[model samples]
Target: MNQQRRRQMAENYLVIWVDGNINMANEHCQNTLTQLCGVVNEVNQCTTAEKCIETLQENSEKTSFVISSGALGQHLVPEIHGMPKLDGIYIFCGNKQRHQEWAKNWSKIKGVHTSIKYICEKLAVAIKQCDQDQVTVSIIDINEGDASENLNQLEPSFMHTQIFKEILLDMDHGRQAIKDLVKFCQEKYQGNRKELKFIQEFERTYQSTLVIWWYTRQCFTNKMLNRTL
Candidate 1:
């Protein structure tokens, strides 16, 4: 496995919360979970263990983490244990001692939470660990090819340029740093002066790095094509 494969696996994860009535869970904790890891896609809230099981049946390959309350954990963990796609389980309870004792029986249960904040912190930490594990996989597959072969695969179209720019912005680089990155790309690629000036003028007003990145890729692609021709 390589970094790219690991990243694909990481992206396939589905973070879900399970309980009798998910609405009873504190909204703040839910928001925190979303803020920390919800970017994976959406935070799935399952009101019942049955629904969660059914969801897992269809999406197990994408189910990385399942969060359940202590009341539901006893029944839910048994049903989902040994499933192929379940990386780990996190269970929260008002009773710390009971939750800890119950968590001991399962090797997959990574933590026992006594409070919503505690569980949120634990989930965030575990997700980071999961990402690290994915990153640690040894690279075993490699394909050697000629320069022209690789170049032929590089279909640098407008869409490709836009996608690359979006990825660069999604990295959450700071506003000023993004401005600098756009300017750097323009200079490196000898991009259009007029477009660069437009970006410079609009950069402070737009309040979004994504717009800046988009224009930068556009001008950079033009220069690159001219140079190649």
Candidate 2:
């Protein structure tokens, strides 16, 4: 993808796969990409450390995870470790023991793994934690001062959320609202087969009484809602 397209495709999180021996023609490489995509939609491949650093700089506002070969990671981690957008780094190589020695020095280094499956599992946990951290409720001290002044001093995010809640509570969420929401979700998760299936199930069998059940379920319903909020 072009640089502009990649920037536009940035979501809540992305994965960057960096290795000196990455070849798209290789079946192993293709399989690794597929496995990583299963956990995060945007999986970018970089054949060199410089390209990986460039990609990270281009999308500096996005939350990113890097999977780097042990050889490259030894040098690359130090260069990108301080990047605020870089969430976690995983050393992918055959010599786990060798990499683990240096990986221990960096707190952001998730682990030294020989398999993509374990990396994906860890990535899922990190992404979940990031999501939870972003959706936080801030309590304001209204009793200490003027309510209006205190409200004005609140963060923009909190104010926006308050307005959204007020508007949502006043509106009538009837059949049409549900249908619209289903349509929006379908468009948002166009290529994600798993989430698309969940959206279909929700559309087919959703009711007002099941609102709490759906929201509490670990599916697209809660994920999308949290992102929107």
Candidate 3:
């Protein structure tokens, strides 16, 4: 581990609570967690599976743990697994058997708890451990290779910076990461028409690294694209 990795580990993490009925989650899960996870003074709450996914999309870098009730867990857990920077994900289930069956497919899921106390206790421990884990960051030069080759080589560098960059472009998660990278690129080049137009098409198409590689290659090679918007 190096200073960069330590900084990443120390980055503030949010504990998200997902439930179809936000009120129930807040009253039971949020209230209990607010008391237990003091490091996370406030918890982000989402009412539906879609909202939960959107929340994760927007804050994946800061999310350490997520607690989803049975209603939302079925949809939320799978999405959580796809997220980057998340240390743990758990489900609050009323039915043990059904969740157990679902849990079989999601090995990364921390646990399924019937009581709020159990979930909070486990989350607190996991949060502490995740916060403590550290790594050193490395920089990669995209200038060394062709667009496609550079895209493949840039994966490690992206992982250090983007967190979820390891997911393959063929997977849904990978495509989402590319979309995120495009957004990052867009932000990096806010006023550049060419780059912005390229990103717009990237978002509209349903494709893989071939396209992302082309875009990244263009960004890397075109000196004009380098100037900040």
Candidate 4:
């Protein structure tokens, strides 16, 4: 996708990859980016700690995870560790033993890893936990006050979400609806080979009885549904 279109997308969370040695032209760097993008739609690369900090500040409203090279993270983590927008930090370095000593001191620092794949595994779990945390329900006691007044006081977004939920629950989705949904997903993930594979699997085997299974499978269905919410 084009940079402008990507920036406009309202993703719940993003990733910041900070490594002074990052070279996009290198096959390893490109592969690492591909893996990160497979997990999170937005991945910003910054070779300097300053650029990463600036990106975090500029997008302060969004939740973010950072993967920093151990050399930079040693100093960088102390500066950005307390930012409310920063959710988690992973120290990526060639020597995990060296970084683990200091990385263990910070609660926000999830782990120190030598392999990008291991980091991605930990990252997926972190992002899933973040998603669960974001899904919140507020309870209002109508018994203590006027029901109408209490309902009127509800946040607009909450009320709208409730209405949308009710409408979806009332709808009877037929075979055509499933087909259309699959087609829409295919179009949306046109060039993403990984997600496209998941879409195809969903199309081939999805069943109403397995809705919960599909929703929790850490694939395109789960990611897409969560983003829609």
Q: Which candidate has the top score in TM-score?
A: 4
Which residue pairs show collisions in model 4? none
Query: Model 4 TM-score?
Result: 0.82
lDDT for model 2: 0.80
RMSD of 1: 13.1
Please, what is the whole-model Cα lDDT of each candidate in the order they appear? 0.59, 0.80, 0.59, 0.81
Clashing pairs in 3: 5-135
Q: How many collisions per candidate?
A: 0, 0, 1, 0
Clashing pairs in 2: none
TM-score per model over all chains = 0.52, 0.81, 0.49, 0.82
Of the candidates numbered 2 and 4, which has the greater lDDT value?
4
Which is the leading candidate under lDDT?
Answer: 4
Ranking by lDDT: 4, 2, 1, 3
For TM-score, candidate 3 versus 4, the one ahead is 4
Higher-ranked by TM-score: 1 or 2? 2
Clashing pairs in 1: none
Which ten-residue region of model 2 has the weakest summed lDDT? 2-11
Candidate 3 ranges beyond 4 A from true positions: 1-11, 24-39, 135-229
lDDT of 2 by residue, 113-223 (tens): 999999989988888887777676777888655988877767766876785565445455778878998988777666666677888999889876677688667567766
Looking at candidate 1, what is the lDDT of residue 207? 47
List, residue by residue over 1-229, the lDDT tens digit for candidate 3: 3332232221246677777665633566545544433333345667788876776677666646778887678777766686767777788778867787778788668888877778877876665454334333456566645767877877774655453232323346456676786767566444445546666876676365464455244322122221211
